[model samples]
Target: MSASMPQKRYYRQRAHSNPMADHTFDYPVCPEEMDWSQLYPHFFSPMDERHDRDPDKGKHGVEFADVGCGYGGLLVELSRLFPEKLILGLEIRVKVSDYVQDRIKSLRAAEPGHYQNIACLRSNAMKYLPNFFTKGQGMVYTMTDVEEVHLWMVKHFTEHPLFCQVAEEDLVNDIIISRLGTCTEEGKKVQRNGGKNFLAVFRRVEDECK
Candidate 1:
């Protein structure tokens, strides 16, 4: 590895974190109050100057969120895949999140004008997803090696009124689906272990009541 690249050994953490634990996390009171410029500086302007400028000028919100993003493998890949879209990775582990942040910084330093659309934040997505994202926005992509977990996710998402599973035929054209199993660190580990991966993609649909 290059001297600038982050070493994975230095940022090791347990596989899972207790979401129920009382972890002190700073979150925005509301979505509008959140300052995204710090996360995606290339996409957004400073908060102070934003209000005075054109609403359409240098303003973009995170369109794709990788919840529990471990080591930011997907974020790096998606940066090259979707240079036009802003991607954010939310990881709860402090060391792991710091490693990802450093990794992005090194990559940006190594190659200028690249990897600016990607960023990582230390956040518990389960507790603060609503605080960062508004209702009826973005798609959810989930994959797991455990059959029980996969089934559980399928049951909950399929049962939800606002979320509908994307059809297999429809997923054929979406390049993001192809990377789910190949891009992430966990996915690479699963592949090395000769494990099977079950994937489900869901999109938000318009509510009839609205």
Candidate 2:
């Protein structure tokens, strides 16, 4: 059993077990029944303007997900860039998830019409990803929330049945429009320091998750 993240960050006696992850989760039977209104309030069609009460037709479901979102840096940036697209951050750590939620609330209060497309939830991504993302929901972002990315992290994601590893040829395949390894200042810093950040994208495929 993998032990919980310990006093390395802060002192806590949280019980975490890979096999016992489901004990911490209460998931929906289907994606449609999931309540997204609280997560993306700005996307909701005004009730005053609507004739019938069909939330599904009016609200846009989550298209982007960042598994293991730590401090929710990516969520904040993505929400600003794609205000129309709904994005979610799934963090398993209790205190970390609470911090992210508070972060979103502060951002929303500070600026009008911000962070409406983003929300953070506390849940084990390894165990409950299927609960949030429907089949073929789109690309799953796997940027490590940790300071140093790990080999185990890559292996965990690559092993999941829902995601098929996009090959290196796919980079030069001229099919995928949005490419990984962005050429920004952040990218340059990693490049200069010889950072071992593995660049890969995974497409969600149909699978029987037992």
Candidate 3:
């Protein structure tokens, strides 16, 4: 590994975190209150300089979010695959998220123009997801080695009024489906141990009541 690259051993953390636990985390009051420029500097200009550019120049926001993004594997890959789109990774564990942040910094330093579209934030996605995204603006992609957890996710998402399970046929052309199980660190560990992975994709749909 390069000297600048973050070593995984230095970022070790417990395997599980209680999403319901009270952990001190700083989050934006709303999506508009987020200072995204700090995370993705290339996507935004200084506040004073924004008026001189096209209205759309700095209007881009994170379109893809990887919840519990371990080691930022998917974030790096997504940055390459969707160079024009902004991606963010949310990890709850402090050291693990710090490792991802450092990893991104190293990647950006190694290749100046390539990795600017992706960033990692240390946030509990379970509680803060809504604070970062507006209604009808999120898609969920999930893969896990635990059957019970996978089933639970499927059941809840399928039962939800605003989310519908995406059919397999509809995702045939989507390259991201293939990466869901192959890109993350946990996924790789499961693969190495000969574990089976259950995958699901869901899209947020318009509520009829709206």
- Candidate 2 lDDT tens digits, 145-165: 234464565676678866765
Per-residue lDDT, model 2, residue 203, is 60
Best of the candidates, TM-score: 1
lDDT-superior candidate, 1 or 2: 1
List where candidate 2 sits over 4 angstroms from the true fold.
Answer: 1-23, 45-59, 143-164, 167-194, 204-210
TM-score comparison, 1 vs 3, better candidate: 1
Q: Please give the TM-score that candidate 3 achieves against the real structure.
A: 0.91
Which residue pairs show collisions in model 1? none
Residue 66 of candidate 1: its Cα lDDT? 91
Per-residue lDDT tens digits of candidate 1, residues 33-144?
8888887676677788856244563355778899988999999999999887888899998889999999999998888778888999888898899999887777789999
lDDT (Cα, 0-100) at 200 in candidate 1 = 89
**Against the hidden true structure, what lDDT does model 3 obtain?**
0.84
Native-referenced Cα lDDT, model 2:
0.61
Model 2 scores worst on lDDT over the 10 consecutive residues at 2-11
RMSDs, each prediction? 2.9, 8.9, 3.0
Tell how far residue 16 is off in model 2, in angstroms: 8.5
Please write out the lDDT profile of model 3 over residues 3-56, one tens digit for every residue.
Answer: 389899999989878888889999988887677777877777654554313456
Question: Of the pair 2 and 3, which is ahead by TM-score?
Answer: 3
Candidates' C-alpha lDDT:
0.85, 0.61, 0.84
